[model samples]
Target: MAKKKTTQDPALAQNRKARFNYAIEDTLEAGVVLTGTEIKSVRAGQITIGDGFVTINGGQAILTNVHIAPYENGNQFNVDPLRNRVLLLHKKQIVRLAVEAKEAGVTIVPLKVYLKHGFAKVLLGIGRGKKQYDKRQSIKKRDQERDLNRRFKN
Candidate 1:
């Protein structure tokens, strides 16, 4: 039998700062463990991953600071808006990430959240924190680019 074609788009929520504040070295896609209400909220686009960070705890990868707002009709069954959600990754990947995170100034952060075939997913990136000078350079470069674009339009 021929394989079925899929029309699913692979994106949900994006953390814009993840690209600006860090030099991302590697990225990995992973599944997120969510409660029923949380899933409902995400499907309705009521999720925020801006301040979230990833950590390996007790041999498992987990996400912290992600906020999924409660469904308006869901009172008793709603999930906590700021709970730490678990991430699903392989053991080898977890070990590698743990070792890499121990290196100076390296950390794990969630870059985006998206859906794949109706399942919620998140993009995790291993990044090195940018120094103050680096951030300033990026800002200067962005400003120059904007000016160049404006000049071209005139």
Candidate 2:
């Protein structure tokens, strides 16, 4: 029997804070629409999805607040860093997300950005914002786990 091979995405950037601020309920892999210069910049890891958010405007899904630094060699035709980039998804998927986003406390956030077989992809998550107490509880749980692991090791 042959083992199935899974390819690793060429991850150029990620928003580490997303892990701490929200409890992700569901995740959707999306294709990002980008220009040539933007693609080059992303490939070089000059990008930030830290402040980005997913929104549905005019019946289309858009990724806003992402910063893709200008390509060093792309002096004449560089794309703007904060432009609203469209996210490619099925019509049904978009409609489902749009409805879900209308609920209170549910928001969409970017989790990671990477290249999949030469094309740029964004991993979007449907997340619920965590309360301060919830965050503290999570931290405490993590600390307990670490302490248990240390004890077991010794």
Which candidate number maximizes TM-score? 2
Tens digit of per-residue lDDT, candidate 2, span 32-77: 9999999989988999999999999887899999999999989989
What TM-score do all the candidates reach, one by one?
Answer: 0.89, 0.92
Give each model's whole-structure lDDT: 0.89, 0.91
Task: Give me the overall lDDT of model 1.
Answer: 0.89
Residue-pair clashes, model 1: 1
Q: Once superposed on the true structure, which residue ranges of model 1 sit more than 4 Å away at CA?
A: 1-10
TM-score of 2: 0.92
Candidate 1 C-alpha error for residue 100, in Å: 1.2
Worst 10 residues of 2 by lDDT: 3-12
